[model samples]
Target: MPQKATAKFIVIEGLEGAGKSSAIALVRDFIEKHTGKAPVCTREPGGTPLAEKIRDLVKVADASDPLCDESECLLLYAARAQLVARVIKPALAEGSWVLGDRHNLSSLAYQGGGRGLMPLVSAVSAATLGDFKPDLTLYLDIEPSLGLTRAANRGELDRIEQQELAFFERTRATYLSLAQQDDSIAVIDASQSMAEVHKDILAVLQTKDW
Candidate 1:
């Protein structure tokens, strides 16, 4: 019999409407097919009970008591710390591949680039996660305007999703810049049709030896 596949951490990242949900489904199915076992799926700022509360705090804002950038960044790390320690680490230890909806990369892009808190984000990430990172990240690239349009079509926009267009522009710029610097990140043009996008994603999975 073939040896069981090694545990791996794979994350899907993108703008609000970059088709991340679909991408995640595909990746989850692919991992199950290859490993003959379902991977443990998780989402950042979530995955755990305490982290879910943090997620609500981050996504829902009170106009009277707005969430400042520094506070937002710290809260994200708090959620991340909980998720990593409680969910991700344990699942990985048990030799189960972990599939994540979002990870540290989202903070680097949204909080670091969108909110201009890279210094604080970097520090928090270092302290919270140390050297932990996804084995592979699939970044779905899409124009901010188009992405927002898609998001709006889906439902009411969240607090972060309600940000000005310039915010998303900054976030996208950061994502592209970071992807260029990291080979573990693969950029997929999410502007393509679903068929095309899935094809590209499959290509990445098949080609990358990870």
Candidate 2:
């Protein structure tokens, strides 16, 4: 499993409307500016055709055949497996750093914490990913209410985003808890002004050897 000498997998994680898109863009530019190498960007439950299909299934609401919690979790993993094997792994092996919009942390927060399926999520993750994980994870922390408001302003709510506020609260709590335990995970206050948030992100990246 030897990888490219300078390849690094960096993932941006957060709740809905936590400004992950902008954060990813910032990280991408930062990496290119600092390292002089463009990163291969990806998104969880996507990054490939098959994975993109799975993403749609996971995001869209179905009335007659509603997606169960277990099904949702498994579907996400299925998509992840596809992306990791077909895209992320190959890119990394080819000397390309990967900048991701979201990764396994999303499932840990959304399914494990929100759906109260931590045990299942942990087991599935251990089985699927083995020791593979992002070298650096930038977690943007935002209040659920505030995040949801932003999401609504953006457009129609997806099935997942349509979840109750309590669900997002649980998800946020889990995100913070995990960040506390993992030094590789950097927590950023997404509630700040965009400029302030970008400044904090830059400060974090500066500390890295990149």
Candidate 3:
């Protein structure tokens, strides 16, 4: 019988300024170096061409007509639907590792928790995209205040970034709660020095043989 090939799907998740993008880049580089195979690095709300358009609409829309909580949740899953259909599923089918900057957990945190929408968003997302769970999820944990400070230093805030500190605190709590519920999820102290955080992340990936 032919061996069943397995492809790892890893997601780096966190709030704004939690350094998820940087972590994804580092993981992709490490995977390429070790396996000589470049992991497909992408982000939610914008991985595929269609999804990218949705991302812009979600991120740049004015706050006056604030996206309703349910609408926001639906938009996120809509982007994920496109991304999975166009990018993620195909990549995994081809035996390429998929490393996402954010995944479904992001919707759970940002939309369900931060926005105080229905808790069923997570379930809806999972049902919408069956068998799409990440093999490993690295949650960069940090205090909301610290994250906001870091984000402010970076530049102008985006729509989500402009949310109040309380919102982020709720998001963080949601992430932690999810991590506690799922064994595949790992929490990293994102407040540490960049080098140290990178090292910790690398160690986790190495242990998983990613």
Candidate 4:
């Protein structure tokens, strides 16, 4: 009998300015420090070249074109498909932990709940062949107002961030709902200081013994 191979795929998810990028970097550092191997760090909407182009269109494009929510949802999945095929799948098969800034859950929250593209979510999930599901997802929880403020301070708003406050409220609520429903997802309170948030994430990873 052969010993089973273990590969952990962790994702950091939250609304805009939830510090997902920083959290992912921290997790990568933690993994390297402990395991002597640097996990593969990447992000959705822009991992591979093609996907990145799509991401730019989705985020930076002017709003004059009148893009439908369903179309937006499909584009997300399209980018995801390319990313999985080109980057994530390969990294995971090589026994590297693939840390993603945002994964499928983001689509479920932003597109499905926030944009009211419920049917598109299921359609895209099925279309992607279900090849991507995070082994563990860390949802950085924060109040919408706080998150929005942080985002505004950062710089110009992207297409998604430009959405109304109510939109983000729905997005945040959806994230919380997912965390409650999924045992694999751990919600970390992100409203605390950066040091505290980092400590909370480290604690979660340690408890998981990953």
| TM-score attained by model 2 | 0.97
lDDT of 3 by residue, 128-209 (tens): 8876689999999999999999999999988878888999999999899989999999999999999989999988877874
* Ten contiguous residues minimizing lDDT sum, candidate 1: 1-10
Q: Which regions of candidate 2 fall more than 4 Å away from where they truly are?
A: 1-4
lDDT of 4 by residue, 1-210 (tens): 121267688899998888987898899887777666788887888899899999988887565786678778888999999988888889889877788989899998999889877787977787794655888999999999999899999999988888898988888888888789999999999999999999999999888855
Clashing pairs in 3: none
Candidate number with greatest TM-score: 1
Q: Please, what is the whole-model Cα lDDT of each candidate in the order they appear?
A: 0.92, 0.92, 0.85, 0.85
Tens digits of per-residue lDDT, candidate 2, 61-179, equal 99999999999999999999889999999988988899998999999999999999999999999999998999999999999999999999999999999999999999999999999
Per-candidate RMSD, Å: 1.2, 2.7, 2.7, 2.7
| Whole-structure CA lDDT of model 3 | 0.85
Model 4 stretches with alpha carbons more than 4 Å out: 1-5
TM-scores of all predicted structures:
0.97, 0.97, 0.93, 0.94
Give candidate 4's TM-score: 0.94
| lDDT over C-alpha atoms for residue 192 of model 1 | 98
